[model samples]
Target: MKFVHRLCVLCLVALLLPGGPARAQSQLVLAISEGTSGGLDHGRVIAKYQDLANVIGGVLRTKVSVVFAREFATLESGMKDGKFDFVMARPSDYPARGMRDNGYHYLASAQPDGQCLIVVPKDAPIQKLEQARGKRFVMPEQVSYMSRFCRAELRDRGIDLAKENVQYVREQAAVTFYLDNKFADIGAIASYSGPARKLDKDGFRVLHRSVAQPYFPLVAHARFKPEQIKAIQMALVSLPDKAGGPEILQRIGIAAFDTSGEDRMNVLLDWLEK
Candidate 1:
């Protein structure tokens, strides 16, 4: 009886140890924050990311669940609290902050870095960025991330938006509307946005484009082991080359995943803050 009791106790200890059956069975949560305003519904968001989550789970040999973080505050707070095991989000700055202020590790960023396009009517005489000074401007809502991104880029070019005549709109389409109707001289829109994509067809031109920054960054929590982190990173970076990879990329709206944005991510907050 004594030997049997000792054996049972040893077995119990073994099961409780790290990487044991109990630990391996645990599920990790992946929080996705596309944006606060004008994001997909919960069901659609899950549908979009479920396959990617399954791929991650397959690589880790553990179950991965998806959760949508609809608000920036919620996403930021969750990262700071280490509530998420993995995070893949856009507007890039939030994920950048997750790495800097919160204890998260960079995994990868979506391909085709994001840029703020300085748009103007095709017939407009503003051929240079310097010529944009004192011109009327329209941009995404004042509090939105793109607005901050545009402001930072413009600031670097010596165009202080605080002094410029500006109209803040709720949507990128409205930025173009303001320009089309002669309500604004120039506007800022994200390079990847739909409105920017149709600029040429709509008789608009990009007067200037901001330096590209990492877009839609994916990060892992600090609790991830170095080997585990490397495995996850490798899995994501190679996703586009794998079977069903192209479809997944199409669903996620990215060309491919790039793991080389860590250095740029580290300095992102500094650029935005300044």
Candidate 2:
């Protein structure tokens, strides 16, 4: 009986030993912020984020981690709110209003240049940007920066925007529908979306591609530790020119986060003010 009690006590001690669930803990709360807007799945996105974090901290020796949170409020909020330390945010939507309130600042930008494309149904006869007038054009929505940038490009080219022929539909896939059902003459999408062949089996072709813009931006909380910020900057600057580069880029869905400093963003803020 005494031997049995001793064995039970040893098992209990093993359950409570170091490296157990109660003892093992994480120090850093590294996180990626993303919006739950529209139909995007949060769980899938978070899983991708965890895989990337393993590559960096596990492979790169940064001891960092990555997490994905789908709250619109968390995504919009700034770093000083202290809820998040890092963010892989799209340039179109960051420093969302009224959360951290100090606004977000850039740490690095995806090195890949962005390209915009104009699309039309495989059967449509429209051949020119000007042909889009009085014909409905499908774009994501007003709140998206890509949509605004596309509209601004047309406006700068002297196209009138307030005409009865001009209109916007809310979803990008809607562009596919408009083309498939013959509901519209044109649509716009990321040039990288590549010929709509993958997005839809029905054919769609590119009509226009925009001059490239700054690739996606990586942002961090204003309060991120200085050492952590510097380490990230160093890692990006020294990203090897071999498999490491392509590997990291593939995980982040960009070619590289460029060495270009934050000053490059001044033009963006200027455009916003203008």
Candidate 3:
């Protein structure tokens, strides 16, 4: 009888111990931010990171699952609630803001820094920035970094924006479309935006280009252990050179990974404030 009682207690203790069958934990969750206003398919975004999740899982020796935020607010709330172990966010989106608000640490940035440009019809003969003062300007909606860059550059250059006719488009590509069709005299777009591609074919000249800024970055929440953060950072910065990494990075629109400082991110935030 005593042996039976002892066996029951032993079994209970084993079940209570760490790594026991009864103590199974949930898999880790990796959240990717969606800050694009429109023209983004949520499923595609989630699928893009699925392989990335697998890579991270291999690095950590644990299972990892990927979740894509429906939009900016969803990502912001999730980060504040500590729902994500890690996040990949755009510069004007959750990464920098979340780092300031939720103690997220910078892990790595997508290489080939981002730049914004003001473009005019190739034959417009608008050689000087002042020549665009009274032109009809088409820009992306307010949420985009391109929009903010355009506004900041105009303000800094002492251009009287109030004197010009400005229109906001839903997508960056639309800006080029409008400019190409003569709906607007000038347009603003990101250097790599769809419209930038039409520069040669559709005929547009860059009137101004903003200085380079850090690309989208991956960041980790403070709840992560130091070792975990270090491992993630190392894995990310080495992705460009890693064997299977180039393909993944290309699919995600990243040229490479950067371990440089986050100062450029701060500079962008400052522009946002201005």
For each candidate in the order shown, give its overall lDDT on alpha carbons: 0.91, 0.59, 0.77
Candidate 3 C-alpha lDDT tens digits along 1-274: 9999999999899888877656445467788764664555768776788778877777778778888786778788988988887788764446887788898877777777777788888888789888887789898987566787778778888875656799999888888889879899988888767677668787888888877776677777787787877787788778868898988888887787786757766565776666
Give the top-scoring candidate (lDDT): 1
- Candidate 3 ranges with C-alpha deviation above 4 Å: 1-26, 37-43, 160-163
Stronger candidate by TM-score (2 vs 3): 3
**What's each prediction's TM-score?**
0.89, 0.69, 0.84
Residue 173, candidate 1: how far off, in angstroms? 1.3
How many Å off is the CA of 218 in candidate 1?
0.2
Instruction: Give the lowest summed-lDDT range of ten residues in model 1.
Output: 33-42
Candidate 2 colliding pairs: 111-256, 134-165
**Per-residue lDDT of candidate 2, residues 1-274 (tens digit):** 9999999998788668875544434334455644323444656665556555554464335445565655656655435466555566554345332112554555676666555677887668888877777777777676666676676666655555555354466656676777678676777776544344364356876777776655555666665566766677666655546445566567656666674746545455444334
After TM-score superposition, the amount by which residue 188's alpha carbon in candidate 3 deviates from its true location, in angstroms, is 0.3
Better of 2 and 3 by lDDT: 3
Better of 1 and 2 by lDDT: 1
